[model samples]
Target: MTDQLTYLLQKLDASAHRYAELDKYYEGRQPLAFLSPEARTALGSRFGRMASNIPRLAVTALAERLRITGFSDPALWADWVRCDLDQTSGTAHREALLLGDAYVIVWADRLGRPAVSVESAKQVTVMTDPGTRQITAAVKRWEDRIAKTSTAVLYEPDRITRLVANQIGAVGSGFKVVDEIANPLGTVPVVRLHNSDRILDRHWHSEFDGRGHSEIDDLIPLVDALNKSLADLMTTSEYVGRPRRWATGIELTEEPVLDEDGNETGETVEVNPLPESHRMMISESPDSKFGQLQAADLQGYEASVRVILGQIMAVSTLPAHYVGVFTDNPASADALRAAEASLTARAEARQATFGRSWEQVAKLMIAVRDGRDPQLIDDVRVQWADAATRSVAQEADAVVKLHQAGLLPVSTALAKLGYSADEIAEIRVARRAEALDTAGLDLGRPA
Candidate 1:
């Protein structure tokens, strides 16, 4: 038991560090410290200053795009879990996208009714068995600064252990077990939703197994470059507008002055310096031809920044037109579709991983509500919104063609055209009602 607790504590600390690193990037802070002056300025004479500015544009853009393309629709699956999700603030999906993972904890409320809630990665950590790669326990650690206390809720397969510590850092107070309750679900009540998965011996193999990488990791360099390029451009602009100059044939003059006591005092000196503002400085001779320091050609820097942004889009699988400014005509539908193909693929990949977690959450909700194991709800699947960018006319034509070819039913085609199951069912019922009304007969009456 001691070993297990120690292992979980170690894993929790590691996960916390990973989360902090990712969070730093998300918050527009540099995750890595600037290199030493000796290393960065090795070839100092010719090169410019080190690019140390931290910009969050790439992280912000990637995260926003992922949230829009990945989890814009929370209740994509059209199931009982949707109800539970709706009961929350409807930010569970957004949290998952931002944090790379989110947690759902299922339990019974005061009325003994099943309830579900979301937990950010910062507050929750999970420990998985090495051999099975299955979650053995989950911990919810939170600090109450106002109350000057820290609480840890350890959820195991059969029971929940709540531990409280008076001082925050003094974990040695040894988590005093305040309460223990039997887990009715008979399994870990927490489900982990991951953004992506990694292979074994790798970082992220299972749902609760790894610290999934955030979408912003790859775009950090590009974002830094973009910011630096912009800074250089601004510097160039300032230099061009107010060129620096040097004054020549100017000398300092000193003259002795009388003091208040009528005695010879220190000499008063006059030192003439070049004008500091953006005005012409008068020179004594034609030899002093106000020379301007060469301002960098900003065109190259601007173009390089654009290129970096393009690379960011390409590597992140986001559409170029979406992130970059478009001066030319808007891209055609086919062109747009081609551009978004990679983004669609990425969204699909995320769906596959997050979907399983949603399924588990749904099953847990069912188990809580019905007092059943919910093993029968295996078929409960997540319904993802269409990730592709297509015009309505194009989608309608394709659906029509599929229906004409007898490859899909009309209802199924409509569903494929982005209609939810509930909406489709309602449409079908309305059509049936209209048909019955047209027949001028009530099915309940014996006409």
Candidate 2:
């Protein structure tokens, strides 16, 4: 038991290092310390933080579109809402997208109802079986700064042990057992929601288990480039993006100096009458005509920034417009669909992978609530909101054609038309009532 707790704590610390770095970028904290003070001055405050939020944008653009509507099991779906999975899942999903994986811990509340909560990767880490990818042991560690104490919870397949240390840094020295809880589910109650949880295709992910690929990891470099270019542009605008007027034959007029008491002094002083950054310049000689030094050509810097954005698009499933590149005229419906094809595909992939994890979570919730076999809810399925961007006419036309062709069922057609579950149920009831009324009437003879 001691050896297992020690190993899990080590793993927790290792994972925290990576999570810290990712969290910094996701929160718009620039990783690079500028070499020059001017660059910092230009991009250090509000504008800089805003420009560095590209990584944040990349993660959220897809996350916001992915919503879990319902579960296939009606009773489970009802329980899902009662458990407040809607709000908790929103927070968990976005964090998963940002940090690669987020865990949901299931337990029973005081009311004997299933309680679900999201744990961030920063504070939680788990060791998974290599073949099954099921968590063998998990630990969540947190420090109470005010009390100068740290607490760690180790979650195993059969038991949950809570341990504590004197200080956050002393977690390695050892911890005394503070509490323990029984988990009879025979599996860990924590379920992981992953973003791009694929094996190592590139150098981005670890070859080991218990980790998933982050959504913004690869985009961080591009985000840095974008921020760098933006800082440069802003610096240029502050230094030279504005027009400067130069005079070839201006005279420095001399005036008698005045003493502090307003008495004239013998010394004469020369002062250039032109104010700094003034819009106009005046001189007595004809050669004094002002020649303006045009503002710096920003196309190069902006083009470089756009090139970085283009590279991001090339590597990821994001489209050009998602990164803020826009055209003079709005894209045609077909063009917009074509552009967002990859994005939609990515969202679907998330729905598929995340759906499986959610199923596990639902099973855990039920098992915690009713002490029943999870396999009883084997028919569980995740219902995702439509991620496609289509016009109203287009959706209606496709739904009508598919339903008439017998390719899509009426219930499915209503779903395609963006009807909610409750709305569709109401529609079906109304239809049934209308059918009964028609059957009772003598329409054939009256018409």
Candidate 3:
């Protein structure tokens, strides 16, 4: 189970990366649809042809790779897509709950009142003295009343015993503890509700809406509604049609002047300082925008992925969505297939690398710990050198760029070869000294 779960996480990570890649490719969009002739013409035939399939291919491929249920079920997958769109629109509405309390129906005749006499009234109270505090509650009734009403008391020992005994029956050996006024230690009793039949006449309704409604019915619509709501909210949430990326309000409307005369000069212009009202406003905060988008995407993506993976793990057969997915759009179909392949490869590679690296790091640590482990140190050093060479070859440009930036940690150079922290630190300390005659420092310069 752990291995399977780990595989799934790695798969999820790869799927996320692919999604991000495709998002960049298409500049963030949904699946394409059949364009009207005029719309296609305006976009140009090639543009219309390729551009339309981008989202479908990306999302479909990601789903297929994730092995979600809808992959085999087109209709179900379509619903899921609709679900995604619905969630994206962000129409969130709260659900209302029904609350109720337990009540009893008493017989007016038993209480010495005529059933037809509506004017007469009767009242009864149940009280319990817990020794620390006394709780009292009253039930009021009118003669000839046929409906039910509620009377609540603190859930004291007597009330609970009564409710339980009334509901379950007094047959079993049951006991309860009650607080005593004199002795703080408390007292126990083999007890039961005195008037079980009388109490049983009342029905206990959950105080909150306890209607057993299908969550699927509620959740699907809710997610769709939330997406719609979000779409509407976004349109009004921020400054729309502003020229500057992060500019808002008057600052966006105001033009910069090159000179005091306000002439249209080619020289650099100094814009007026932002007004007080919009002073703190920014056109866009990359961090905030990125974070929000990521969070929203994460929620929907995670839910969809979980559902898909669950189906894949449970069923021996693939869903119809998986088959119909190919027919949806060719480009997307290809992408989806590729995404599936990519996810599997990534998961396998991550598992293999993690295990291998952990072992290498451990061995290096042991080698550095004591001076007599030269062979072990040499073996690990050889492995690190081979890995480094492959890494450089795979992405030399990225490596050079990273080296140029101070962003790469000082420890990275020492640790990149898979040395343990202590091992790396010991090397650094020894290297800085005048001369290292120590046994641990002679790894022959980290390759």
- Residue 331 lDDT in model 2? 67
Q: Model 2 over residues 211-272: C-alpha lDDT tens digits?
A: 66788878877777777777787778877998776767788888899999999999999987
lDDT of 3 by residue, 196-283 (tens): 1121222224221111111122222323333333332332233232223333243334454456786756645446444535536444
> 2 or 3, which is superior by TM-score?
2
lDDT by residue for model 1 (1-447), tens = 445555555556656766676666656554223334563344343334333332244333333323211122333334343444633423555556656668888887776666777888787768777887677888888888998887888899989988888866324246788899998788899887766657542354432346656666676667666655655565556556344566556654555677899777776756445537536577576665546565456678778777877777677776666665575325698888887787777766766777778777767766776688756655566565565778999999998999999999977787778775666778999999999796776566685
TM-score of each: 0.74, 0.83, 0.15
Using TM-score as the measure, which candidate wins? 2
Candidate 1 ranges beyond 4 A from true positions: 1-3, 31-98, 169-173, 201-209, 240-295, 325-330, 403-411, 425-447
TM-score order, best first, reads 2, 1, 3
**Model 3: how far residue 268 lies from native, Å:** 21
Q: What are the lDDT scores of the predictions, listed in order?
A: 0.64, 0.77, 0.29
